[model samples]
Target: MLLVIGPGAVGTVLAGYLSAAGRSVRLLCPESALPALSAADEIVIDRVTGGPPLRAPKPLLTTTVNPERVTQIFICVKQPDLESVCDLIPPALPPSVPLVSMLNAPSAVHRLRERFPQHTALPASVLFNAQLLEPFRARVTTVPRIQLPFEHRQVVESFAGTGIRPVRAFGEASAWGKLLLNLSNAIAAVTHSTFRDILSNPLLRASYADLLDEAIRVLRAARIPFRAPLPVSLSAYQMMMRHAGALPWWLARWKWRLAEGAYPSMVSDIAHGRPTEADALNGEIVRVAARAGVDAPLNAKMVTLVEQVGAQRPPRYLSPAELRSALGHHLQT
Candidate 1:
């Protein structure tokens, strides 16, 4: 049995996939989302990655956690919700049930390990793009994959033949690598663009290239083991970044089939006036650079921009040019 906390996109993605794979799953969500969730008879697993949407019939949905029957737990909420959700976990959770954190940042699982010293806490980097279309619907825009801390067959095999595979190539390294790639998450939120737009637009592409260049330089200076975040290598992405503003004729595109609802988590957060993980995603890069006696002003800039935008009642908006200008002389090559 699996108890997935937070019925957001990622959480719903996990439930839908696991439930399809014949695993018993329960979703724990906030009370506010319950009404809309209850309206839907089943969780909708919509795919933009070349497939028809599938329905995963009712798994138990609750506002509270029932740990007694839960044989496994997946923490799918963002960093801000971590503490409150941690309090909901049964104090006597058996050591066998791993508290697997599928949060965006690698630091989340580190905090989980600190919170429950005796319990087994693991970080699993979510290597997929999913957007929450509704309270009970999640759209996967990419083929979903997970990077487990190690080859935990019990967890890996559960998703087998279910479209979500646990590829154990780089593990922790891939988690950090994913963080570096996610520096663009804030760009989507601040610019009011779809996650696809960030990479599709030449200006947005160049802006993110500037940010990624800054992060990579610092990570190398700190001697962190940089590896592939997605299935492709980091070097491959960096090469793409090099041709950031190139047209279709100048380069080969991945040709991602994105849905209209395909937006980043931060984009969704700002739209709904909820808090985002900008601090965790971009802020993590800033902290790492600071500890290494370097300044990650670009990443620091994103953290502040996301905060400023999200703090607005209507959510502050910026165009790609305005956003790039806001980054000021830092992005001027």
Candidate 2:
């Protein structure tokens, strides 16, 4: 049996879809969420790319994880919630059951390894975003996919026909590479712009470029490998961020395709008065830059901005120009 922890957007979508694919699955949600999810008895995945909505059979929803029956565990939670959530599960879970960390934080697997010292906590990068429009419905703008370490190949059989592809790669490198794109999530959250707005608008793209470049520079200085999340090379993806304005629409059409009413997950958290994962995503760059004896002020500033917004409800959203200014002198006036 597959035990998917959390009934947040990612958890519900994955557990629901896997169950739809005829896999044995269960959803471990917070105590407060149990009632609503239990009442729904299923989740609806509305695909922005078009087609009928996917109705995922409700997997067994519960507040507690029965380690005895769980064959594998997929942890789908924000970075700030990691330790607290892990504390809810029994430490006696079988050592053979791999703990898949499908988190935006690049270092989540390392953190998971620390917490579950005896278990194999494999790192996975969620290559798609699913937004929870309501209690039991998630919207997928992009085709849902996940990137896993080569070591995760053993569990690939569990994903068979689940509509979620498990692409194998060097986990650490892929996580960092994905972080480069995720930096924009904080940008969208702070500016109150849709993910599409960040890429489509020149000023927003420039601000995003500034953040990406800063993180990229820090990684290069530290000699950290930046393997592409997909088959494309890091240089190619960077080019898309840095010079997207000069390129034709076709050159960047894929970006638009995947972003439908898409704001970063942090946007929702901020809107609803919850913590964001700015620390795990942008904060990783700041920590690495410190270790490497480099400056990552832009990423650091973003971490502050995201935290502030989440703390103060009804945030006064920053305009693109203001955000670019906050980032520093990287843009023209």
TM-score of each: 0.91, 0.93
In candidate 1, stretches whose alpha carbon ends up further than 4 angstroms from where it belongs are 244-261, 331-333
How well is each residue in 103-194 modelled by candidate 2, as lDDT tens digits?
A: 88768888888888999988778877788877778988777778776556567778878888777768588888888888989988888888
**How many residue pairs clash in each candidate at the backbone level?**
0, 0
112-175 per-residue lDDT for model 1 (tens digits): 8888898878778887788887877878876677877556776666677877877784656777
Kindly report which residue pairs in candidate 1 clash with one another.
none
